[model samples]
Target: MRVQLILSEALSGLRRNASMVVSVVLVTFVSLTFVGAAMLMQMQIGKMRDYWVDRAQVAVFMCREGAATTTCTGGVANQEQLDAVREKLESPALAGIVRDIRFEDREQAYQNLLELEPDYADLVTADQLNETYWVNLVDPSQTDVIAEAFGGMDGVEEVRDQMQYLEPLFSALTVATYIAVGIAVLMLVAAVLLIATTIRLSAFARRRELGIMRLVGASNRFIQTPFILEGVFAALLGSLLAGGAVVAGMYFGVDRYLRERVPFVTTWVGMQDAWIVIPLLVVIGALLAALSAGFAIRRWLRA
Candidate 1:
């Protein structure tokens, strides 16, 4: 009888204050959406780090104009130095880490450059082109070791891994992710406080009933159940809304936008990522709401 009464009262409160209920839910949903997006962005960074690590290019840029010795230091890699570098890269000590080595002469690099930007053809002539090695490592993680080994070598003016190119982009994403997550956290705390306030108002409205119950044989558990249930239900609804919004945002907007428009970000988050994030967010939302409501009720009970 007590359980049924509590459930009935909970339903009545929800129906009576539908607007407030909706407000609580909407706030929760928006808050959780931000949380989900933050998680997704973090995952996206992890994905990029993983994918690029395997494909990082080890570059061996030769020197400029020739000097006394055909050395590459401040000059282009001569035939002998280039050949020796290739042999060292192919050696057994490095073979496990060396995937494929391609040599691009000054002329080839210029031709490729001209192909990319014909208008710049007049800017740089093939004669001034510098020969470089496009070294593909078996694993990108080995970049530090390989780069250190060959960077200061006799013929190499500079050794650079293409992954260095992605540093700026990753750094930017990291900053954005942190900022977004921080904002989401601040908003979530606000939502929690609002929910507590709203639930407290509802409790105040039912103060007469609570007072009557206290005078009667009602236990603390009996009086608190309905309020707890109310908070739980509100949180659950909000989570569903937020989770759905996140999935839609990713599917129609993020996924399609990236896949069709920007090819680079596609590899960052796959379909699997969405599948994983949704359920996780839903769980988070439900738990957060229930806990918030429980805390609110306990606070009101003390009063």
Candidate 2:
């Protein structure tokens, strides 16, 4: 009976402040949606980084004919130079760091270039290509070690870490995530303020009932329960809406569109990720609303 009465009073308060309830709902919905999006973006960034880090290699390009580098003045890497490089790689100094190394001769390099850019078939020849050593490190971050070892070596033109090209992309994504988080925080503040205002107004409208209940010796918890419930109910509705939006976006935007359009990104935040965000959104919304409403009503009662 007590639970039913509290629920009835909460519903009545919501009806009295219909416009404020709607505002609270909309604000919570937008804030939680941004929160979910920021989380998924971070997750996508992690997936991409993990996928690329495992596969990214340090390319050691051997000197080709007519190369300009001082180390390539010998014109091209001779068999003796290649053997020396192989020996040094297998040497005790680098054995622990180098996980695997694959040597690609000019012909293999040319074939790969042709496969990637067919138009170059007629313009480029096999001899023009550099014989390369693709080195996979046990830890991708140890690229500088390989660079230091081979950068000034005879018959080596250049040593390039593939991750250097990818850092800018990751940095850009991180900035975007920060922007989303900033927007979500601002919206959440708005939602909390709206919830507080709504609860205070409801309490003011029922001041007479509250006074009578106080005279009848009703506890503060019982009196505050209905107003807190009103805020929680509105927040819950908004959270549900946000959850639905996140699910739809993952399905249509990520799964159907991005996965197909962006072939390079093999991994994406999927339905499973959305499921995780949905529950989090609900908890965040409810907790924030409860605290805001509870605080607002407590202050109003004291006043």
Candidate 3:
């Protein structure tokens, strides 16, 4: 009976302040949507990092004819210099660090270039390309070891860790995630304040009824329950809308469009990630509403 009465009162208050309720819903929806987007962005970043890190290799580019580096001043890397580089890679000092080594000779490098940029075939030749040792490390993070070992060697032009190029992309994504978080936080504060305002107005509109209940010996908890429920109901509706937005974005934006257009990003945040985000949005929305409404009503009662 008490639960039914509380529900009835809560519904009545919502209907009385219909426009304010809509405002709360809209604010909550926008805030939670930003929250969900931030989460999915971080997840996408993690997937990219994991995928690239596992396959990252160190390219030890041997000096080609006319190489400008001081170490390659002898025109091209001779057979003895090439052999010395290979011996050092296979030496006992680097046995545990070097997982696998594949040598790409000048012709193979030229062919790969042609495959990537077919226009280059007419202008470039095999001898113009550098022979490279593609070294897969046992631990990708230990790239510095390989770089230090071969960086200034007679036959080597440069030691390039593939991850060096990828770091900038990852850093850019991280900055975007932080910006989303900042926007979400600001919107959430607006939602909380709006919820508090709505509850105080509802209490003020029904002040006479509250006084009657107080005179009838009703407890403060009983007086506060209906107002708290009103806030929670509005916030819940907003959270549901936000969840739908996240699901649709993952499906249409990521799965259908991005997956086809952005071939380089093999992995993406999918419906599974959306499912994880939905529950979190609900919990956050409902908890914030309940607290804000409860605090607002309690202050009104004291006044």
Per-candidate clashes, comma-separated: 4, 0, 0
Measured with C-alpha atoms, the lDDT of residue 137 in candidate 3 is: 90
Error of 2 at 62 (Å): 0.6
Tens-digit per-residue lDDT, 11-47, candidate 3? 9999999999999999999999999999999999999
Taking all chains together, each candidate's TM-score versus the true structure is 0.89, 0.97, 0.97
Residue 279, candidate 3: Cα error in Å is 0.6
lDDT of 1 by residue, 1-303 (tens): 867888998888787667888888888888888888888989989988888877778887777575334345446566788888888988999988888988888789988998889998878887676678788887777888887788667877777888878989999999998888888788778777777776788889999999999999788888887877787788788888877887788888776677788776547576678778888877876677667877888889897
Least accurate stretch of 10 residues (summed lDDT) in model 2? 264-273
Residue range 75-149, candidate 2, lDDT tens digits: 999999999888888899998899999999999999999989999999999999999999999999899999999
Q: At residue 70, give the lDDT of candidate 1.
A: 34
Stretches off by above 4 angstroms in model 1 are: 1-3, 66-75, 266-268
Which ten-residue region of model 3 has the weakest summed lDDT? 264-273
Error of 3 at 223 (Å): 1.1
Q: Candidate 3 at 57: error in angstroms? A: 1.0
Note the residue pairs that clash in candidate 2: none
